[model samples]
Target chain A: MTLAPFEGADALVRRNNISSQGPEGAPAIVFGHGYGSSRQMWRLVAPQFVDDHRVVLFDHVGSGGSDRRAYDRGKYDSLHGYADDLLEICHALGLSEIVYVGHSVGAMIGCLAAIAEPTLFDSLVLVGGSARYINDEGYVGGFEADDVDALLDSLDANYLAWASTMAPVFMGNSDRPELTAELLDSFSKADQAVARQFARVTFLSDLRSDLSSVSTPTLVVQSTNDIVAPVVAGEFLRDSIPGSRLEVLEAEGHYVHVSDPEKLTTTIRSFLG
Target chain B: MNPGVQARDLFDLIPCGLISATTRGVITTVNDTFLAMVEKKREEVVGHHLIEHLTPGSRLYFETGFMPQLKAHGRASEVAFDLCLSSGETLSVFLNAVVDRERDGGTILFAVFDATLRRHYERELLAARRLAERSETRVTILQTATTAFGNAGSEEEVAHALADASRAATDAMAASVYLCDPSGGFSAPSSSGAAKQLVEAALLDALGGRGDPSPTGGLAQSPTTVVYSGSAELSAHFPSAAAALRTARVEALATVPLIDDGALGGILLASFGRPRRLDPPTVDLLESLAQQSVLVLQRIRLRELISYRSLHDPLTGLPNRHSLQRRLDQLLTGTHPNQPTIAVLFIDLDGFKSVNDRFGHLAGDSVLRRIGASLERAVRSGDMVGRLGGDEFLLICEDADEQSAGDLAERLRATVRNTPLEEATGLSVSASVGVSIYRPGTSPEKPTGDALIQLADEAMYQSKRTGKDRATIIRA
Candidate 1:
């Protein structure tokens, strides 16, 4: 489900390449993409509901086809800035009771936006999302703080090669080389500074407090063998989000819709229906 | 697969690197072009975990963004990453992958394309944009400073304006303008900016004995722009100023000396928290600001001196006849609501003609000057005493009552009698002072300054008729 993204104030509109397609009279579903990728990641799922539900897609200001000149370091320093953009987008479109589908960092961004503007959304779908990435007491984020520092160091030393090395890890089904090739192509075109900043905002952010306030009908899409958002993390999201449902997909990695689209779509339909 | 689609994947003719790996990211296939791209044989790239060939950042990206997408989708496409060539040059590439579960545990296919040239162009564009932005900021600062300089009025005002302009022109912590007075004294008006505590200390440098005129002074030596970057360098050159700024957390300083002809007019000081390099245009902007301020300061000083000469006597530096009349006019008519009474004592010296005739005019002039000073000391603080041209002096007292006026008249008489006129060899002279009081309620005529002077003059002649060294009051 998607509704046309909002466009008011030329600077904000141009900074974020917000666009949409679907039946105007239908309920709206706004799609938020994760870091390192843009609205292009929703190509398969977004088109499926366009005939009945309004489908909205957009590239966050530092990614995809967004105007690079408008990227301000002061404004993008925290995750709240990203959430503010989401609220403004929905506000501009004059949409209420929106269906927000978020993946990875985008999922947390949606949760924060909903908390800030409760009337804007009625439901939330969190796909492979985690509140904190650093391993803490009684929490398994899978990476140590030193590991993150090393990652930043490597990014600084050779950014271009870093992208290539990351593709194999992200696209774990490396047997099918085309899957990773496409993902890499999507990453190569992004501005290096924007990419690095998005990385910092995503991993360094902690929004566990934001989850308890999300009273909307929420669904946490958990993958069986997902390495990014582990089973425990998905369970944590389901537990933290009051009255939220958890549906486990028999997918191999963190990305469920791309691996088993039928199962993910069927589960969402059942929950919403 | 169709022959045409299958032929497209032919190793040597593909014109790109191609590889395949299982779900665990263990490499299974490596094409000739891929081997050629890394300058490695098939044995080198094949049968290696994808993690082994990736850099730490790339590995992080894979675990975070890439691996998740592929694991869920079963196929991922158009992802970008870097590859280190054997020749030690970095090459950017794009990859496309699809999972195949038949032969391996979700075997993935890979297609890569070189994107080094594209990346170069994008980098060049981003750099150009940033340079343009910095230049725009410089233009805006200069424009603001030029306008402020055009409107400044006094040396103090100009110094104040320059302080504001200097801080705006450069991103400095604080800025101050120090100026030299004609008497070899230096003073800096309070300046405020990012660092207030240090600026107070910088002003103290101008206040100390360094204000003394010496051609080889610190500010005098800095006729051109000077910069001290870092704490060590700043402390070595400007020890006191450096200490203040350092305490305020400032690490750098730049000074532009203001010199008008051969004299040092002032110095402009700005403190910074980082090492500063003033480019040619920026230096020119500061130097021009200094030049404009000196011109304005000189003009203001000349105008002030001229304004002073207009209302004061050249020889004795006392207010002239015109100034006294104007002051008297203000006191008489300016009080609107309250008709508070005022008194004017007009004194005309007795026996002064014989001294000028015998001892000459030079001794006469000296006696007049000394008497003028004595009369000044004898009057109340609020009274105005003026030399209204040769031997005739006028004193105006405001807010006075009848009893107070009478007391002041007697004091004037006694003081005049006590003067032992000097240097004429035993020549002791006294004066007859006529007091005229303008009590608006009891006055017979409209109170005017000229009328009051005339009445006081007439009363002084009456004192002379009754013998000198006495005061007579004329009721007006």
Candidate 2:
């Protein structure tokens, strides 16, 4: 498994020379984990791509194994700032014509960076990407404004309840209850205000028109029954973008990458080839 | 657990009343606390209607509204109502009603608690706070009255009013007024009966009216001159009144100055026999009253000069820029939708700089002042003329569209066509005018004070591009 952590470029850069195990000159494929998960999301999927491409996987700023001191709310108010860090990493590694694989908010950041600088990425593979997580007129993303507001209020009202309720879902375990404590520890690492700001920018940004201007070859992979990102939203993205393709996998829950990695990996490899 | 024993023990130990009511409002049960609180017996009230146990006034309230709410909602918590005792005394209680649907189809359970003491204490506390706020308002009004005399219209009126108010405030017997003369003389200008007699008999009699003539006669002198010139020395000059006035057990003696025409005109002297300390703000207010008297006297001198310069501009003897700018800013900030467009043409001379540079500044000054007169005659009566700065002028034309602004710009350009020093030294002089029309929504960029001027300045430079002695109008 390859580790690729996304840290803000303006933040203190940690010089961790984590070794890469893939083709030396192949276009780099950087993976971004979704909310409440870490770089380990790609552990099962990275092995299949490592032999053919330069695979990079990392935790987002304030997440697992990344520099914790680098998270600042003033600088990281929008996903564009996160996209800036993604571009910085590409520039740092001298990787061009790369493919970005992002989940949830990570997918939105990839789309933003691609829109802002079209030539930086050759293609974007968005897994569970939503232009806006909250629904409004002419759009039917899952959550409403009040629902997102309640989620934020609950996150503030009781951190312990928030951790207990949300950690298990991200851990994607019903049979093993012991993984909940480990997931809670990861969620508690960043300041609560910074976490709330990140949630607001992630869930509230409207990127419907942005998909129309995307010149990169795009692949949107969604879960059919995923409670986090719905199947209709995947079709909306496919129909809106000029040449983007959508593929839905028959999965039970939101964390399909963990539940059925073999099927997800095969689908991604076939599409990329 | 034995059911009977547990039930009997629980019934006696419960804190609230537990009563049962029938469909027609008859009381079936009463606990010991409820019986004690209402001073009633279980045997007397158990079979009676619940309305019989309520006070006459409360019985009407409960039957009219309380029973309907409980029957409709099934349960009503913390309902405030009154109950009557067997002795006919009223007790305030909070009742909770629970209606049971099984068995009798509607068996009502009532829980009652005493609430009289808490309600009484809350009412008393609120009343005390209201009384305190009322007293605070009276004190605020009294303080406002004490400061009113300072803002009176005239210096003499302020001086007279302050003396009367101070005497009334401190119950003083008499008051007097003195003013400092420029040659270091303190003369009594005005006085009441007893004060005038004491000043004449004490000082004039002792020193033959020439006792070093009070060195502290200036406006900067302290209120108490006894510190700079000793009280003993003042007593030596006027022993009788000094001794009487000093030993009169007075609460306060205040002196406020009357200033007018850049000199100390007079002072108001107030003395009281009763002991009191004047508040500092009240004393400062008395001083301001004297200053108001002086300002009133000086306003008469300024009124004539003010009226003379009212229509004419003080700088150029032409109509002032204020009236011109008022008319122009009104046209720019238009009130009606279909009002005609207006143009503001900013004119600046091209070669007036070299005239000022070559000739002495006096000759340059005369030429610029002459150009102001020429520009005044060039525009029609409805048009506005203004001197913006050293060599710059502004012409405001009403109801003028782009073509009219172009025509007016040409006339202004031709009017100042002759050179100033060329008539004096045979050189050519010309002026540049920039015209911009005020239109709606043409400049999508937000309009600012500088943007309008810059638009006109750019048009003027376009005329300068046609090589001088020309006018250009820029339409938005």
Candidate 3:
């Protein structure tokens, strides 16, 4: 059956309500989007998984389908707040043995939630993950503090232009120009200040110590030629976490899941099995 | 070819180079600039092979790829290759091959452009950029260090600030500041790293057993003597120092004296894990920090002395009237708001007038002092006992309701009645005890120190009216 266009999650579900999709007996899978994007990021991937799994998608408090009124700045300022929301959703749905698939900042939230309440999920798939974005005493991730600062300034100057420029690089689809417009729309939908704060929290936060605390089985998927989230960052994540398997896809860039869906799906399926 | 063309016009005419090559690799057409660059003349040899005039390396490269690629492809555009001239110098050149489709494709046109100057300019720009970045980092470190020192207002603040500055300045794994206590002994007061263990070790050694001998001598003796020791004991205990010296890494260490009035208050020891030379400018900064720390220590000491004087009596070292009253009010009124009731006792000495007449006022004063001592011993630590004025004292008992107050008052009366005041002063002395029970919500005005004292005093007068050395209960 074809699904209708989702009404904004922030409007449809009350702050306290839990929303679910797909059949009850199906294998449970939760989809979490990154900073600027919403649950709509999973539009292509969710449908493919739904035939076998109960696909669960919800917006973070301040973003696309969640209750904007319930967004508390102090609580939503860090990854811990998103983790709290994820845990709340798990409790509300009585979901167990679930598989969590997260992208970018969403990957960090999934890791945090898994650490906080390990029994909530059985496995985690982190795409384009980095424990610490900034280089420190021991580790060296390319891009200094100023480089990140420059990126933030670029984002602030003209978010739509920045999104358009980055979308082509992220998806690695220079042939298709429409993807850039889609990304620009997603970025423009959220409040600029809120998105800025979210970006700062996502890119600047150091989570090296947090990776060691995660007990659930994890899969680290990295695109071979991703410039935004480099291969070295993926290697760092793989090395930091215990028992985390790393799968390096020959896919072009950061948004490999969208660009090369068949390869991504095959890898995830094999890992999950 | 255009033989009448002017040298400047022909040489600088196009952005690309111009040349002619024969089937046997002889340069038949050479411009005035190309002839000057190769240091050749037109009459000297138009028949000589171009490979023979060029350097051995260039001859090999031209024969191997350039000639073959041009011959096969008909034209090659923007081929970057190195050219070695007769002067033994190599130049990076962008070579473009031109072939006239009408000319049987036998003769090839070679155009060469000089790129050495551009490449050199780019290299210099990159080097300058790296230098600018390093200079900017140094300035940032200096600014952060200055701000840190300026914000340090107390010994703890200075220690914490120094630790933060060292970490930022050197980018070390950890930084710490150890301070000396009053006894000329140093300990890690504020620190980072496994600071607790290091603090305990330093404290143990300074206290005398022997492990890591004090890095800074007791600054408590003389502030100037508490210099940065660079001692073996320091390197042995502090991992930062060892890391600095072993790796030749830049780790900063600064020791500032916590001085007060030329006497050493303590020493502030700051250390990082990289090898940092104590430069003249850095030493000067540290010295200024030490002086400022002295001022801070003095201000803190003055504040402490003032607070002590306000809370205790100048004469007997007991709490003064102001502090005693504050304590009494807190007990009687229940400052906690959740507690229920409280009690107050007022005692006035009796028959002291006759002692002042017969034995003299000195003996009566002695009797009062003895009573004060006895009263102090009778009360619990939580209870507040204070001299309200001459021959009159007040006691406040906490968490005591009306019934408990009556029992305590009777016990106090009997104890005073049984005391042998006549033996000590050669005059009989007794106390009139009055008890006041606090009633909550009766007086819309909360009970003040004066109000509670007045109630207890009135009850004491009633005790005196009936008989001295007796107790009377007054309910508010």
- Candidate number with greatest DockQ: 1
Which stretches in model 2 have alpha-carbon errors above 4 Å? A1-20, A72-74, A161-190, B1-476
All candidates' lDDT scores? 0.71, 0.62, 0.62
> For model 1, how does the per-residue alpha-carbon lDDT over B1-476 read when each residue is reduced to its tens digit?
68886766676668887788877676788777877766666677787755445544455667665665565456655565566666776566666777787865468788877766865664565457546745776677656665666676667778888887777666465777877766666674535364454455564464343454566655544466787755567767666665465445455677777878866777777766444556777778788778877887888888889888888766557777788889889987775536788888888887778779889999988877877778889989988887887778788889777688778877876776676676576666777888888877674457789988888888888888998877888878
- Cα deviation at B120, candidate 2, in Å, is 31
Tens-digit lDDT track of model 2 for B1-476:
89998887677567777788775566777777777877877787788767666653344335323553454457766655567776777776777777887847568888888867753563465457445644554345334434544454443443445455444332344455554444645564444323544543343334222224365433343332111122334455456657554433222345565656544555666543222234555555445545654454356336545754664466566655555566666666763546676677878888887777788677677776777788888887888887766777778777788887888888888887742453237545688999877765555543443455567778888888888767778764
Query: In CAPRI terms, where does candidate 3 land?
Result: incorrect
The DockQ scores of all candidates, in the order shown, are 0.06, 0.00, 0.03
Model 2, residue B121: distance off in Å is 28
The candidate 1 chain B region of ten consecutive residues with least summed lDDT is B203-212
RMSD of candidate 2 to true structure, Å: 33.2
Writing each residue's lDDT as its tens digit, candidate 1 over A1-273 gives 233354554555566777767877688888888876778777778887787777777778887667767665434545666787888877776677899999888998899888877887889999888877767888877566665654554344345444555555546634665664665666543455567667766776666655898888899988876655677788889989999988878775555656566777777767768
Ranked by DockQ, top first:
1, 3, 2
| Structure candidate 3, residue pairs in collision | A9-A65, A10-A65, A10-A66, B184-B218, B249-B275, B250-B274, B250-B275, B251-B274, B251-B275, B251-B276
TM-score of the B chain in each candidate versus the native B chain: 0.70, 0.35, 0.53
Pick the TM-score winner: 1
